[model samples]
Target: MPELPEVETTLRGIKPHVAGQCLRGAVVRVQKLRWPVPPNLSELVAGQTVDDITRRGKYLLLHLTGQTLMLHLGMSGSLRIVPDEIPVGKHDHVDLLLDGKRLRLTDPRKFGAVLLLDHDPYASPLLAGLGVEPLSAELTGDGLRSRARGRFVAIKNFIMDQKVVVGVGNIYASEALFRSGINPLRACNSLDSKEWNRLVGDIRHVLTEAIAAGGTTLQDFTGSDGRPGYFRQELRVYGREGEPCSRCGAAIVQEKIGQRSSFFCPDCQK
Candidate 1:
């Protein structure tokens, strides 16, 4: 699944080609998507001008004349900007025809979605109740500490909670915890102010660096330009299980937490 960094990279990559372009039309090659591509999307988006392209968490929002199109690139989904004359492939589900270029959505598992709405987009259920953006000013050490107070769940699971903070997925949570030198199994409520401060700073640092590297390509994830991310080269522990730990020369091990694999150096992250 694509995370915050991948979505942010997509927003940046496609903005140059799609911004300010007139929407000549829309084509729903297959209406059956994760949520059934809105039946009236094609008619509603025709002849409108694109206002801007932005990202919230993992969803991409296309600001149009009177409505906003919310797109979620679910597991194994990708959006590419291709020439109009290019032929669509087997899994290509939708296309937005611009004056010059086109935007195409490809999803192998059909878990991605394209939605159209005419009301205030933030109020939509899909966007509502989402936790604070991890990259925003609201996600501070004190803020996270307050939320974790009296909570006995694992710190990794706590930060991965969408209601607590959005976009801290499995890979990022593992990497962030490793960077902060915190064991992934630590109870949330046991953390002190000092630990919270380090965790918060490291989370921001890891995520910012991942976005700058165009996101880590673990499985099916790739940038809108179809290029693999470079961040994987700098990862300290996420995928280096059973390898020598760079800091302490101890073996990095893996465990299943919340059904996600967590790689960490037992000696370094105590």
Candidate 2:
């Protein structure tokens, strides 16, 4: 699934072309996605100008004057800019035609979503319950330490919780824990103030770097321009299981935490 960094990268990549541009046309080649594409979505957005484009957690929000379009890239979905006349591919599910250009959504797995919100999208159930943005000033070490009190969940699982902090997906969670030298299996409540501080910094660092690199292109992920991310090359442990640790030369280990793969340097982390 496209995580926070990938979603943010997509928001940045397509924002310039789509922001302030009026939607001349809205086409839904297929109306069935994770949830049914809102019928009459085209009518709702066709004449509106894209006032802004922003990301919340893993979802992208396209803001118009009176409404918002919420999109989730799902497991194998991507948004790309293509010429308006370009022929649609098998997976091209939706297209927003603007100023002779097109912002297209392609989801081979059809698990993505396109929802129309008449009220504040931030207050919508899809987005309202989400936790703090990892990069936001509100996600300080003290904040994390407070939330972590009495929680016995693994640090990896705790951080991955969307209600605790949004957008720290499996890959970034592993990398962040590794960078902070915290064991993924460590109990959330076991962290001290210093450890929490280190974790906060590492989370910010890893996410910022990933966003700069356009996010990790593991499998079908790509930027809005259809380019693969370069951050995978900088990964220290996420998928380097059984390989030598980048820091200590000991074999990196992989385990299951909350049913997701958790990778770390057994020698360096913990």
Candidate 3:
């Protein structure tokens, strides 16, 4: 699945090309995605100029004058800008046709989504329920501490909770925990205000760096331009299980927390 960084990267990559461009048409090659691609999506988006492209959590919002299209790149989906003459592949499920160029959404696993929203996207159930964005001013040490007041869940799982703070996925969560020197198995309530501050900073630092590097290099994830994220090369503990820790030189370890494999430096992150 594409996490926040990848989603943000995609938004940044396509915004310039798609923003202000009029939608000539939309071709829904596959109507069934994670949610059914709105059958009349073409009619809704046709001739509308893209007002902006923004991200809330992992979802992308293509804002138009009066309509909004929300997209989720579930497990294996991506959007790319291509010339009109380019041939669409089997996985190329949808096309947003511009005057001479188009934005193509290819989702091999069919887990992605394309939905049309009549009103404000931020007020919709999808975006409205999300927690404060990790990069936003609302996410702070005090904010995290308040949310974590009585939780017994592992700090890893606690921070991973979207209700606590959005967009800290498996990869970045582990990396941020390692960077913050917090053991994944430690109880959330065990962390003090100072540690919460460190953790918050680490999450922001890691996420910003990942977005700059284009996100973790996963098997199926790539940026809009087919660029694999180089941040994976700098991972500290996410996938370095059983390998030497970068800081303390102790072997990094992995364990299941909240059903996701979490890696950390048992020595350094203690």
* Higher-lDDT candidate of 1 and 3: 3
Model 3, 1-270: lDDT tens per residue?
A: 688898988888898899989998899989999888988888888889898888888889999889898999986889899999998799999999998989999999999999989887889898887888999999999988888888799998888888788888888889999999999999998999999999999999999999999987678787888888888898988778889988989999889998999998878787
TM-score of each: 0.95, 0.96, 0.96
The model with the greater lDDT, 2 or 3, is: 2
List the global CA lDDT of all models. Answer: 0.87, 0.90, 0.89
User: Which candidate number maximizes lDDT?
Assistant: 2
Q: Model 2, stretches more than 4 Å misplaced?
A: none
The collision pairs in model 1 are none
Residue-by-residue lDDT tens digits, candidate 1, 1-270? 677888888888889888898898888988898888877677789989889988888889999988999999887788889888988899889999987678999888898899987788989988897888989998988888999888999999999988888888888898899889999999998888999999989889999999999988877677879897878888888878888988889999999988888888899886
**Candidate 2's residue-wise lDDT over 45-112, tens digit each?**
88999999988888999998789989999878999999988998999999988988999999999989
